[model samples]
Target: MGQFYCLHCDRYFANSTVRDEHFKTKRHKKRMKQMSGPAPHTQLDAELAAGMVGKARAPDCRGTLGAVEGLPFIFLLM
Candidate 1:
């Protein structure tokens, strides 16, 4: 769970010897190859991509969702 954990393979070994052996396995190699590509998106990533949330929201500018579509200006409130 601590030192001998394989993040890409998501597996654990009893000791370093077994873990080292696991690193030489075809399945582990394949998993490492797959992980070498683009990383998978998380829930926060999905939300940001879909405009559900972001780093910071302006005082008046809201999302073009549910109500606004082609609106030119945003409504400001006091």
Candidate 2:
């Protein structure tokens, strides 16, 4: 038996047909969109841009996540 691999989805399929079908799935499409560019702007991004949530640090920057006045404290790992 031969296995077809989808690099984007990091999944293996039985054949090309199955792999191609998976590429059309919503999950795969969403992943592709996310990987293609920066994340879509939201309230949090807006606040960060406006300096309302303190300084927006890079993903690799090391710092403490202190309390923000009007925002919930959340931690993200990169």
Candidate 3:
């Protein structure tokens, strides 16, 4: 992996492919637009995630889930 700093976006990217993908994602464009306007409530999202994780884990009744060991690996590969 390699690092590249995108000055226009004011962020560091791990690789060129990821950086290109970011440029194509709605979020990055939205962030740039927000920079000229208003930023989203990211702190609120963090708080929500924290609260959810803080709650006791209930068994996932939706279905039997296998170990989530390779989820990220699978996503990245895809």
Candidate 4:
């Protein structure tokens, strides 16, 4: 396993020296900036998810789910 890890970048670094260099990279900076924004869940999204409470409103599976770029995994209750 790597000694240093960057959560936003989802990468591991062998050492602090390499990790510091990675942190200063434009790619890492761009990724960090992108990850620091607000979530996409709007009122409509909340309303849709809330439907899980009632089986009548629930879809055959989960109601239409959304996929955003860059997210490795996400689970929304619905």
Best by TM-score: 4
Quantify all predictions' global Cα lDDT against the true fold: 0.68, 0.65, 0.55, 0.71
How big is the RMSD of model 1? 9.1
* Most lDDT-accurate candidate: 4
Question: In candidate 3, residue 5 scores what lDDT?
Answer: 67
Clashes per candidate, residues 3 or more apart or on different chains: 0, 0, 0, 0
Please, what are the lDDT tens digits per residue for candidate 1 over residues 1-78? 546888888887778999998889999999889989765655544564577774484334354322333465545898
Q: Candidate 3, after superposition: displacement of residue 24 in Å?
A: 0.7
lDDT (0-100) at residue 57 of candidate 3?
A: 48
Better of 1 and 4 by lDDT: 4
Q: List the residue pairs that clash in candidate 2.
A: none
Clashing pairs in 3: none
Tens-digit lDDT string for candidate 3 (1-78): 358766657788888888888798887787677687644445534444455423344333123212332233222353
Lowest summed lDDT across 10 adjacent residues in model 1 is found at 58-67
**lDDT of predicted model 3:** 0.55
Question: What is the TM-score of each predicted model, taking all chains together?
Answer: 0.52, 0.43, 0.35, 0.57
